[model samples]
Target chain A: MNSSASTKERILTAAEALFAQRGFEGASLRQLTAAAGVNLAAVNYHFGSKDHLVEQVFKRRLDQLNARRLGALKHIAGLQETTLEDVLSAFIRPALDLSHDGGGGLFMRVLARAFAEHDDSLRKFLSENYGHVMRQFTVEFARLLPGLSKEELYWRIDLVTGALTHAMSGFGIIQRKSDVSETSHREQTAEHLIRFAAAGLRAP
Target chain B: MNSSASTKERILTAAEALFAQRGFEGASLRQLTAAAGVNLAAVNYHFGSKDHLVEQVFKRRLDQLNARRLGALKHIAGLQETTLEDVLSAFIRPALDLSHDGGGGLFMRVLARAFAEHDDSLRKFLSENYGHVMRQFTVEFARLLPGLSKEELYWRIDLVTGALTHAMSGFGIIQRKSDVSETSHREQTAEHLIRFAAAGLRAP
Candidate 1:
């Protein structure tokens, strides 16, 4: 059991890097297994197939992301003192933490690729499995901002998520300064995102 | 000269679709050439090489996007009656038009992938070539939003672009309904995005 768990960990780690660099089709199973320091049979034994492996890669990170977000939301949900920034922080902080931490930095790139690819199956999987987290957040947002219509609220939330994904992808520009500690940088990032998002959501 | 131009056009069109679907490295020259209904020699002869062709694919659409943005900006630059929405319409309308239109629809996906890749050379190319356009927009946004500090202004602008890219990619959801004509839908999109972005930029 111990060996099997470690082997799965190794494959996932290597797959994230490879998928981030080479994309889904570009990173063949041979290269994936090789990068993981495993063989063809090992990958098959552990994950069944490459398709299954891709789903697992997303599941590993997304489960962490959504769980963190829901946990943060639950702590403050429906509270008398909850502000928009508080809920924004709940949504944004966990994502920012994921991208800056050592292992999951590249996971954002994977998510970005999935977004760009617009793969139908992947979209369905995400909605079916993880859509509830977003729905719960939307409910909280609506409750907080009682004035905005449903369509209007959804539009703002969509743009907010867009900004979140774009920032996490580490796109064309934007970076942390060398003078700051990682934790400090993340704190500032969270502040900036939540502030910007809160203002947008509350916009007339 | 006409034949040559059309050949180049074909290669670019094919390249954009392939790159959007297969990504940069995953789409081979052989496939690109075949899909274009041109010979391998045609690609090398026209674009110089595969890498150069990749740049050309981005350049073609980016040049159009920036030109439209600048043209719109020029019309209203320093005009007395311009509202924030007017300036934003100039900035965003062309992009929404690009995606809703047939051919350039895939270009957003390409842009998303390039952003995801975080490729140093491509990033440099973009900033060097098109940086002036963004700088001009920033100056205008700063003028309109005089209260925001330079650092704060830049941070807000960065997040705004992130959201813009995310929305354009059409990842999973948030699409136009069949009942809404594309033009009306785009108009609404522009309104939604500009309102949200204006508020974010003005965040306290």
Candidate 2:
């Protein structure tokens, strides 16, 4: 990578950790710059402003996460034999994989903070950029659960999203045991989430 | 009410709003006291320090919320006739009701922040102070399901909690129509959560 590109990558990496640890508001520019080993000019040169940097932090992970989710959904979206669990796995496995990947779990913590932040600009940015990914998943979910009204489907999906977000944020009690391999632990986590989400989505 | 008592209430109310609007770390003491229309000394006199103030903020709401949860759980915990839905209702309705109650929803937002914050001291405080409520509910949930192993049961409960916390934090897309009464909306929310959670916990 070029020097400029590596500089940008360093800032993004440090920003992700600081933001996850100290929140968007709490993480100061000075601290972020110091952590990244970059100067103020470097940040300004790259991302223009802290707000824009935050957006990039989200875009970096979410773009990949949602793309994988959409890629998975395409295979079974409207298939007659696709079970609810299949649709759920497509939606969930990517997130679980992301969380287990190096530093991806920290990104999930940042995402959770964004949800809690309730910042209007961030919300709008997410909705505008990634809303279609969710809409596509909703369509697949609708195909499998023909009994639910649109409102009901939205409610269930929102709840499932909440559960997944919470779990991915790593705040819950279910920790991976030291004895378990990373891949094994990820698979176990996926199974638990998929089963629970599938049943929740199918609830009468 | 007495002057000191009302002062404390004012601080808590303001703290909840500021914490929700910004965050635990983002909301400064100056802002908190200013919003409360009080001085630094008053906060010090009333709560000693910001950390204690945060604890009091949680204690004020959690005490009432968990009391109601336990009260509801007591009515139908282990009875053979109690359906999974009943146990789920006992656990969920109180939270939904709390979220609709005055300023309680803001507290949920704060709770979400705490989860995201992942502060060790705060986590310990919550576990030590209110852990019993969750334990009681878990016992009842185990009795009702009887099929899930302890580890599996804990995993599912954690997911259900994540979903409920996410929904109650008011970040999800689900919104009440203007025509709907607050009570009606809350009832609808409770129904959706209990049904989803019941099915989730009962998943094979």
Could you say which candidate leads in TM-score?
2
Interface RMSD of each: 1.7, 0.8
- DockQ for all candidate structures vs. native: 0.66, 0.84
lDDT of 1 by residue, B1-204 (tens): 999999999999999999988788878989988999998899889889888998999999998999989999999976778777778888888888888676998998888888777567888887876799999998889888899888788888899998888777666367899999888988888889999998888888
- Expressed as tens digits, the lDDT of each residue in B39-80 for candidate 2 is 868888899988999999999899988999898887775465
- lDDT for every model? 0.86, 0.88
List candidate 1 segments past 4 Å from native. Answer: A28-31, B28-31
Docking level of model 1: medium
Chain A TM per candidate, in order of listing: 0.94, 0.95
Error of 1 at B81 (Å): 4.3
- The residue-by-residue lDDT of candidate 1 on A1-204, one tens digit each, is 998899999999999999888788778888988988887788889999888899999999999999999999989876769988888888888888888776998998898777776567987887877789999999989989999999899889999988888777766356788998889978877788889999999998
- Model 2: lDDT equals 0.88
Each model: TM-score of chain B? 0.94, 0.95
lDDT, candidate 2, residue A33? 87
Native interface contact recovery, model 2: 0.88
